[model samples]
Target: MSRDTAGTAPASASAARTGTARTGTAWRRMRLWGLAHAVDDLYQGLVPAVVPYFVLDRGYGYVAASGLTLAATLGSSVPQPFIGLAVDRFALTRLAPAGVALAGLGLGLSGLVHPYPAVWLLVLLSGLGVAMFHPAAGKAAREAAGDSTAAMSVFAAGGSVGFFLAPVLATPVLVAWGVGATALFLPPALLMAFVLVRAGRRRAALAGAARPRTGTDRWAPFAVLTAVSVVRSVVFSGLSTFVELYWLRHLHASQLVGGTALACFLGGGVAGTLGGGRLADRFGLVRTVQLGTALTVPALLALRLTPGQLPPLLFALLAGAALNVPFAVLVKLGQDYLPTRPGTAAGVTLGLAVSVGGLVAPVFGLIAEHHGPQGVLSVLWAVPLLGVALGCFLVEPGPADQREPARTMDPAGRSR
Candidate 1:
């Protein structure tokens, strides 16, 4: 299928329905969607970055501060799958804009609202907005990339980049303008929402041209994929939350060293997410996932058991790669397992299923309180083995594995 996305303006629905309009879109649109994702997640990341300011500026206690996190998580992560189901049922493309806009608007309003519950409610609303953005945007990204995991990773990497950059982006503004500076973030979301609404209205031709050839919906395999994703999520959240503290407590490292180690872990994840797609493209998706799980075991165990301090940093990078190599692969695989409902697959992979780890994190915290952070790391070492066990239950993607050519052919029907 050829693409007709030379400019921002898309063809009319009538044109899309007729044979006149092109079926596919430009990769630039994926960039646009990716940018929208960054904007949505920037707010999600912004919450944590600003939470300290909320405490210092507003005199919030530890319990109050932690409650904000719970509110944000509950509002955002829990509703993702249901929101995804809504997107699949109605093909709710336009909701992406509303999500982004509300996310930004929530932050803006939070700055103006002085009361704690009101501010929490506003942030919760923002979380809801964040939840709304992923399913539909992910579904669109899947179509835009066709079946290319590398291309899909380009879309997913936006979130990682956003998360990595959030503190960088938010700190200076918060310092200069105070917590009310959250309002500054609103314009990007509002503008992006306007563009997405416009883009969604004109996607008829894009949808028609890029519709999947097969219409398979295998829930059983998708369930296995979700289970594997949950395990990966737990490991990722565990490392992200505790690795810095563990290094500081056990290795007797400075704050700088701990922060650097966390940075290494995250940087490895960004690299792994990009690399996983290429590995999947070459070897196959299921194989790629299994490889990640199998390799992750030793990496994590080494981080716990390595006698010296220096090797732990190397192990952190390896552990991050092993655990995250499946990030993009799992999203693509979920869609493959349920060819008819990419939106719902994206919802689980991108949303509620991943949050399952956060729920278990307190359990790890309890273990840490009793056995120390090293004990927490030791217990985490056993988690990846379950990923391998669940991975065995995954069936291969036959036709869904290669649904469409990655790039649209040129007007002359030659490869681009």
Candidate 2:
């Protein structure tokens, strides 16, 4: 019996060591994927930052500038589900790298070209590249993360950070070199693509094996979740566009204070994204999502009612955090709902659903015209109710509904 116990102890220790090593490797890969996501998304943020410069440098009219934005939006949002389907079918190993490269190239060249059509097309191509990156990177991140929501949040938060960084990073370059400084942004994308290629090769064996099949798909729940996501996006978009205006016009704050408010809100979103995953991991996904949706109502309401300039900033931060708590969870939940087609799930959740908010921005603009930014904020407090209501129908993916096959890529960048 002693001999038997001694023999089992060494084996158990060896197994423990092996498990620890794998976990470490997974984390390393997850961080790389997260950074790659940031690099890819930076270009998305750059578009809005670049648009104002195009008007300044090229003297484009409001219509033409809006057209350029429209081109990018159409390219990035429309074809995502189709692209996602392709990704699921073929598991395109180089898609993420190729997409990032294309995004950089398109945006970089937009400033160098003189013709409006040429600039528009280049921006369009950049948007397409963004469309390409999300599904593929999302799938890769998921495989690397396994079932760890906390790990997945790192990837999601990277995007928020990227968006936050873009205006900061590009403003100096654009100011120094004019719009042509967009070319400077290209190098980072290329560097990230190269890094991803190397990382993909090294981690091929580690992530290639298929995750055990956990359950079948549940479309109804996924549909409800998607609806909830759309509502969240609308509220987020409205706040992002109008928050500074709210501070400036309604609160009688200075431009610096207004800018600071926007920054604080975005920063809170990053924090909330990271915290959401941890919360979900501890409390269950659906519960965390519901909690977030419920919290948003009071946060936004408080922000709207707050009388002072400084006090509202606190509520703005809370509103941002509350609104974003479900952001990462929604992505993971979408994949879980349609376990057989993670790319499609990602495409809709990350791409199409989120983009819907931008479409609704004009509506909010009209509201602001009638009632001011404060009115817009007042309306936004009600949007989260839809999310909270829909969230009631969102069950945690049960054993019969939670399997996702691992997507594998060979060293040569081919799906195996």
Quickly count the clashes in candidate 1.
Answer: 1
Which residue runs of candidate 2 sit more than 4 Å off their true CA positions?
A: 1-27, 47-70, 108-120, 171-181, 203-214, 245-258, 307-310, 368-375, 400-416
Tens digit of lDDT per residue, candidate 2, span 42-70?
A: 88767656665775688864456556656
The lDDT of each candidate is 0.74, 0.79
TM-score of 1: 0.77
Give candidate 2's whole-model lDDT: 0.79
RMSD of each candidate relative to the true structure:
9.5, 6.3
Instruction: Please give each candidate's TM-score.
Output: 0.77, 0.80
Q: Highest TM-score: which candidate?
A: 2
Runs with alpha carbons beyond 4 Å of true place in candidate 1: 1-29, 46-69, 107-120, 168-187, 201-213, 247-259, 304-313, 368-375, 401-416
Candidate 2 residue pairs that clash: none
